[model samples]
Target: MSTPAEFPVTWAPRRTRAVLLPVCALLVVMFAVIAVALPANWQFNDRVLMVLSGVLFAAAGLMLARPRISADAEGVTVVNFVRSRRLAWAEIVGVNFRQGDPWASLDLADGTSLAVVGIQSGVGKAQAIADARALRDLVHRHGH
Candidate 1:
């Protein structure tokens, strides 16, 4: 069996952040530059709106980068795009990351599953599989 990951471990989609953050920043800068370069006759509010739109886009990008999972001795904390949940080690039954799945997920004892978007196959398949295995090892060591 594989060794369990140490407590206080955290996993996130590095590629997603590396790619999305810079693109978002670039888009924001482009929007700001376009706003400033608008035709002289355009209303000032229009420029403000353009800049605000850019801010919104950046916010969305930030949200997309937010998914992460952190584990400690007591439990694991999962932070997805719009929600965060804490699950004790005992609460997790298993970790699943089948082919074609966007990300890994935790099957809980309560018959529910929680998506672990932090380990996304779309971002990096090999890394995601390794992460899922690490998580499975953790569950076997601590939860079972």
Candidate 2:
């Protein structure tokens, strides 16, 4: 059986393009450079660079593709390649929408911050603001 408290509220990677598009662009640039600079017989070095580049490209893709939000009865988690964060429902004091901001974030009672990685950054300003406000309200209603 399920109760109101049992329902899970989850947010995930909504726009992977933020992570993927840059990595893809870098890969293209690197490929062009390698093709232009390397000689035909440099097989070993070419292979090594290709392998390294492939690893980095894959890493970036994975970071972008990875799920960024998971909220359950306990808390929510947000993952970023640079840094990941977890916040218990009790830990989050509030959520706010900022003017001219590029992304959504959680404002903790401790005066720290956590970006809402699942929100689309480039969406229409009004819609994004409204969504941010709605998320804040949800936290207020159901979180701490």
Candidate 3:
């Protein structure tokens, strides 16, 4: 007999720290340099604090650059930085891949377009195209 699976939905693959960490580091460094080079009295100024806070935020954002998807056996869950939404299989109207749009998109019955965020854009044009096609096929095969 086969064992039942554990989680119904899981986070899709994303770009690892090796890629995102450097970008974050660069920004942090730049901010730190500015913060340090400011007038001595400006260290306690609100503007300086604001800049430092922003730099800290950037680091946090970089550390959290993972794309996650969570759901039950019923549907898929997508949570990107700017948006968080869910789509049941029945709610998914269709899948489409085309030029200009980033990655694949799941067209919803309600008319909202949800971008698929798990794929890395830096993987090159060919990989992106293949990924888009693969996602489209998967959505078509299993999604409504």
Best by lDDT: 1
Better of 1 and 3 by lDDT: 1
| Residue 89 lDDT, candidate 3, scale 0-100 | 72
lDDT of 2 at 83: 70
Q: What is the lDDT of residue 88 in candidate 2?
A: 80
Least well predicted 10-residue stretch by lDDT in candidate 3: 1-10
Best by TM-score: 1
User: Please, what is the TM-score per model?
Assistant: 0.93, 0.66, 0.62
Higher-scoring candidate on lDDT, 2 or 3: 2
Q: At residue 119, give the lDDT of candidate 1.
A: 88
The residue ranges of model 1 lying beyond 4 angstroms of the native Cα positions read: 1-5
RMSD of each: 1.4, 5.4, 5.2
Model 1: per-residue Cα lDDT over 26-68, one tens digit each: 8899999999999999899999999999989998999999999
Full candidate order by lDDT, most accurate first:
1, 2, 3
